[model samples]
Target: MIEILRKRRSVRQFLDKEIEKEKIDILKEAVLRSPSSRGINPWEFIFVTDKELLEKLSKAKKHGSAFLKNAKLGVLVIADTRKSDVCIEDCSIAAITLQYVAESLGLGSCWAQIRLREHNDNISAEEYVRNLFVLPDYYLIECIIGIGYPKNKPQGHDYSTLQFEKIHTNGFKND
Candidate 1:
């Protein structure tokens, strides 16, 4: 598990090769199995593999999302606040776990943030994605994870130094 965690990194470029169905299946299983608060599991995933649509999705944000155009698969992570008040937090954890699982499968993934952003002039990122994907208004877009065989491998963040400065024994003690 530690090895997988260390190996996982944001991969923005990909090859033209296609991902196998077995790999996709494993990703689905990992996503669905994610634990949620109160077991509400307020998350839902919309997968996009069409090249044309993926390209359009890459423009779902004004910036920081151009890589979706190269993603062999796009996992639009969303949550329905109607299902749980803590839907955002739940979806975030699921997204992280999903990426970790992807790394374990020898795939690379990059998460594009979209929760509080805009696509262009006046379209909110959530609205932009929702409109493009035709998703219901009840859903809130959390992020989009671009997955594929990396065109190049990115070295993971070196953890050897371990930022102990940020760690606290228990609670913050006022200096």
Candidate 2:
């Protein structure tokens, strides 16, 4: 797991190749296994492989989402707001689990945050997604994980660059 973490990097550029169905299934299982608060498992996923839809979804936000147009798959991470109080946290764990499984399978993934973003002046990103998918009002969009074969795999962040100072002892102490 540590090795996978060491090599994992957010990949925005992907090759024009479709992800294998077996790998997609594995990703499905991985997210289902993701830990949730009291096992309420409020998260849900929409595996999008349609080219036209992916293209449209790429415009979900003004920035940081254009690259999703080229992704072979877009996994919408949403949650039932009424199911759990920690819906965001549960969705986040599932999203990261999907990403890690993608990395382990020689696939690349990038996350596009949707919870608090704008698609345009008329609507929020979440609202645009809701309208696009015709989702119910009780569902909350957390993010979209764009997955595909990487066009170019960038190296992970160097260990020397890690912020070791962020780690604290038993209690929070000012420097």
Candidate 3:
């Protein structure tokens, strides 16, 4: 499991192949088993396999993430903000867990931020997403993850050069 976590990367490019039903089921099980804050379990998932909708979503953002179009599956994680104050954190944990599970299942995944400053004030994108899923008002779009087999291996990064500079032991930092 540690090795899987270490090797997982945001794979944008994917092979032109469809994912197996059993693998998708395993992925769903991973999300369903996530631990929620205060046991609220205030999370909802929308599995998107429609190519047309994926294409539309790929163009919804300015950066133009074409990876959505190639992904075998896309999962939208929504948090019921009306249910708890820790909805965002809970939803985020679920998203990361799903990503890790995907990696463990020999699948590649990447997270796309859907709820941020750009979409909060005015939820045009959110509206589109909600309409696509026919989601009720109680739920809010938290994030979208694209999953599939990788087309190419991700490049490696060196962390040996990185160092913790400002982290304190217990009290205030000393100069």
Candidate 4:
């Protein structure tokens, strides 16, 4: 797992190739296994592969989401707010789990944050997505993860660059 984490990087540029069905199935299973508060599992996933729909979803945010148009798959991480107050945290865990599983399968992925983001000046990114898919108002859009074969596998962050200062022992120290 640590080796996978060391190699994992957010890949925005992907090769024009479709992901294998087997790999897709693995990704689906990985997210479902993600842990949630008291196992309520409020998350819902939409695995998108349609080219036309991917193009539309690429515009979910003004920035940081244009890469979806070229991705072979986009997983929308959403959750039922009515089911849990920790929907955000739960969805986040699932999203990252999906990413890690994709990495282990030799695929690259990038996350496009939807919550608290804007598609346009007047419309929130979440609203645009809800309207596009006609999702219920109770469902909250967390983010969309774009996945595919990487055009270029970028190197992961160097260990020397890690912020060791951020690690605190038993308690917070001002030092």
The candidate that achieves the highest lDDT relative to the unseen native structure: 4
lDDT of 4 by residue, 43-72 (tens): 999999999999999999889999999999
lDDT of 2 by residue, 1-175 (tens): 9999999999999998989999999999999999999999998999999999999899999998898999999999999999999999999999999999999999999999999999999899999999999999899999999999999999998999999889998988778
Among all windows of 10 consecutive residues in model 1, the one with the lowest summed lDDT is: 166-175
Residues 1-175, candidate 3: write the lDDT tens digits.
Answer: 8688667779988999999999999999999999998899999898888899888766545553567888888899998888988888889999999999999888899987777524334555666677777888778888789999999868534456335666677788668
Q: State each model's CA lDDT, in order.
A: 0.90, 0.96, 0.82, 0.97
Model 2, residue pairs in steric clash: none
Cα deviation at 78, candidate 2, in Å, is 0.6
Candidate 3: which pairs clash?
A: none
Q: List the residue pairs that clash in candidate 1.
A: none
Candidate 4: which stretches are off by over 4 Å? none
Error of model 1, residue 84, in angstroms: 0.4
Q: After aligning candidate 2 to the native by TM-score, how far in Å is the CA of 37 from where it should be?
A: 0.8
Q: How much does candidate 1 score in TM-score? A: 0.95
Tens-digit lDDT track for model 1 on 65-138? 99999999999899988999999889998899889988988889999998988887877888989888788899
Ten residues in sequence with the least summed lDDT for candidate 3 = 116-125
**Model 1: per-residue Cα lDDT at residue 165:** 73
> What TM-score, computed on C-alpha atoms, does each candidate reach?
0.95, 0.98, 0.87, 0.98
Model 1: residues >4 Å from true position, as ranges?
173-175
lDDT of 4: 0.97
